[model samples]
Target: MKIYPIETGNFKLDGGAMFGVVPKSIWQKTNPADANNLIEMSMRSLLIEDGNRLTLIDTGLGNKQSDKFFGYYHLFGDKTLDSSLAKLGFCKDDITDVFLTHLHFDHCGGSIEFNKDKTAYQPAFKNAKFWSNKEHWLWATEPNAREKASFLKENIIPIKESGQLEFINLSEDNYIKNSELNFDILCVDGHTEKQMIPHLNYKGKTLVFMADLLPTIGHIPLPYVMSYDTRPLLTLNEKQSFLNLAADKNYFLFLEHDAHNEICTVKHTEKGVRLDKTYTFNEIFN
Candidate 1:
């Protein structure tokens, strides 16, 4: 199996919100804010090529939103979903599966796009089966007041409307073994209900796609949970447990939102699991 790091685009988000309760004084050290107090963030996705299936995990914010809507996020960079796929000598239709960690705008917005005449919305990956868990699908579709803004209907409904949506019935085990994808889904909550983090076995290494569960190296410390999480205390417990397991088993964390650092490993330290090393995808695989 081969994995490709797909750079969809970059955008800005309020550093304070991203870092949650962590003081700006500390987070700014790693992610310095602009004059607007927004820090640049990457909407990074992953492409897995295994035998006949090509799976894409998360589709960064697409270009269908109005300028006014996008202005709020301050989108930047030339990299886009199509461009990234072109670089890998593939196209959207080639994707057999789109495994969404959650249905937040940044993660699933690119799942649908405007038609040529802008008359109606359609599935961006026409031939792909969009994979999301039943719990998260319902949570996003019937969003609560707290997360309504993040779950845009336009980005979501088209997949189901296109007859390409599929739900994974989560098993009792933490690790969901899927024969179709050849990966285990590490189910997580707190950020959102039933966020599925893919644990891929690649080249004798366990590569975990750390969705919002651990955004960046800055969040390695126990208290650095995000404010966006629905249950912060629950997130703390989940993070601690995952970090301990990661440290013990030496898993390579593939970050989805970290703009600068692509992959990192944590080591057991006196202060708890801390960043041990960072690497680009090429550094380790190439």
Candidate 2:
């Protein structure tokens, strides 16, 4: 099996929102912020190739939003879903599954695009089935006012309209559906409902999609949680438990937002699970 890092470009988010209760004085040193106090974050996605399955995890923010909306996030960079896939000698049409960690704009916005007629929305991966847990699907579709702004209808409704939306719930016996890949799902909340992070058994090593749960090595500290979390205390507990297991088991956590660092491991320091080392995805997989 082969996995490619799909970079959908970078966008700016308030450092405070990203770092949560962590003091700006500290987080700023690790993830330096701009004059606007916004940190540059990667809309990094992953493409998994196992047997005949080509699954793309979490489409990044697509270019369908209005310029005014784009003004807020300040999306910048030459990297995109198409270009990144091309770098791996593939294209969107080749994708057979889109495994969304959640439907947040930055994570799954690129799942759909505007039609040429400028009046309709269409699934970005025409041939791929869009994956989201049933509970999270309801949470996003019938979202609360607090999350409504982030859950745009255009990025979502089209997936259902395409007749490719599939829901994976706790009742599922096999997470991957196919026996081709030996990977499992680790579903968690606080960040969002039932966001599924992929855990893969690759070359005697376990690689996990850290999907906002750990986000970056900088977020290893439990209190370094993001303010965007629906439940900050719940996040603290989740991070504490996950990081401890990761440190003990020597698991590699893949960052979905860090602009520079891709994968990192944790170590049990006096202060608990702190950053141990950072490595590129290719370095680990190859």
Candidate 3:
């Protein structure tokens, strides 16, 4: 199987919000903020080419939102989903499956797009089946007040409306071994309800899609949970367990939102798990 990193775009988010209660004095050292206190972030996605199935994990924020809507996030960058795919000699129609880690706009907004003449919303990946779990589907669709802003109807409803949405069967422990997508899925509830993290064994190494569970290298510490997380205490436990397992097994973490660092690995440090090293996608994947 061949995997490629898809750069959809870049945007800025409040560093305080990204790092939660972690003081700016600490997080700013790693994720330095701009004058506006916003930190630049990447809307990076992953594309896996296995046999005839080209599965894309997360689609990034699409360009359908209004300028006023996008101004809040301060979107920037020349790389787009189409351009990235084109560089790989592919296009939207080439994708067979779209595995969404969650329904947040930055992660799954590119799933749908405005149709021709902008009359209607439609699935962006015309030939691909959108993948999400039943639990998350409900959580996003019927979002709570805190997360309502992040789960936009324009970015979500179209997938189900298009009749191309599919749910992955999750086990009781929230672990799926050898899923139909050709990887293991670890579903955690801390970062939203049932956010699925994909674990892929590729090139003799285990590569995990960090998603929001570990947004950036700055978030390696167990206490550095995002404020957006509904259950911060649950996130603490989940990160503790996952980080320990990751350090022990030496997993290569594929970061989706880290604009500067593409992949990272953690090791057991005296201060608990810490960033061992960082790699650009090419440094290891190539």
Candidate 4:
């Protein structure tokens, strides 16, 4: 099995929101903010190539929003889904499965696109089945007031409309596994309802796709949870549990929103699970 990093683009988000109750003086050191106090973030996705199934984990922020709507996020960079796919000699139609970590705009927005007439929305991956867990599907569709803005209908409804939406039946341990795919699902509820993090067993290493659970290296500390998380206390416990397991298992964390660092590992330090080493995708995978 081969995994490719698909970089959709970069955008800026309020540093405070990304770092939760953590002080700017601390987080800014790792994810330095611009003059506007917004930190650069990458809408990074992963493409898993195994046999005939090309599963894509998390679609980045698509380009269907209005200029004013996008202006708020400060979208920048030349990398896009199409361009990145082209670089890999693939296209939207090549994707067989779109495994969404959750239905947040940035994580699933690219799953749909506007039709040629701009009058209808359609699934971006025409030949792909959109995968989302039942709990997250409901949480996003019937969003609470605090998370309503992030769960955009345009990013989600079309997948079901396309007759391609499927939910994973997680086991009692909140795990899902398919024989064809060389990975298992680790579902957690802190970030959102049942956000599924992929634990890929590739080349003798367990590479975890860190969706919003651990956005960047800056969030390695247990206290550094995101303010956008619906249950911050739950997130604290979730992160602690996941970090301890990751450190013990020596998992390679593939970061989603970290623009500077692509991947990192953790060590059981005196303080707790601390950042071990950072590397590009190719640095280790190649």
What RMSD does each model have against the real structure? 1.0, 2.1, 0.7, 1.1
- Per-candidate Cα lDDT values, in order, are 0.91, 0.86, 0.94, 0.92
Say which candidate scores most in lDDT. Answer: 3
Residues 1-286, candidate 3, lDDT per residue (tens digit)? 9999999999999999999989999999999999999999999999999999999999999999999989999988799999999999999999999999999999988999998999999999999999999999999999999999999999889899899999999999989999979899999999899999999998889999999999999999888999999999999999999999999999999999899999999999899999999998788877
Better of 1 and 4 by lDDT: 4
- The better candidate by TM-score, 1 or 3, is 3
Query: Tens digit of lDDT per residue, candidate 2, span 1-286?
Result: 8877889899899998899778899998889999999988898888889889999888989999999999999988899998999998999899999988889898898999988988989988899988887889999999988889889999988899889998765545324432223467877788887778788777889888888787767788888988888988988887887789999999988899999899999999998889999999989888
Model 4 score (lDDT): 0.92
Per-prediction TM-score to the true structure, in the order listed: 0.98, 0.95, 0.99, 0.98
Judge candidate 1 at residue 124 and give its lDDT: 90
Q: Which lDDT tens digits does candidate 4 get at residues 1-286?
A: 8999999999999999999889999999999999988999999999999889999999899989999999999988899999999999999999999999999999999999999999999999999988887888999999999999999998988898889998888777887785224578888998888998999988889999999999999999999999999999999999999999999999999999999999999999889999999999999999
The runs of at least 3 residues in candidate 4 whose Cα sits more than 4 Å from the true structure, single-residue gaps closed, are 179-182
Clashing pairs in 3: none
Give the worst 10-residue stretch by lDDT in candidate 3.
Answer: 277-286
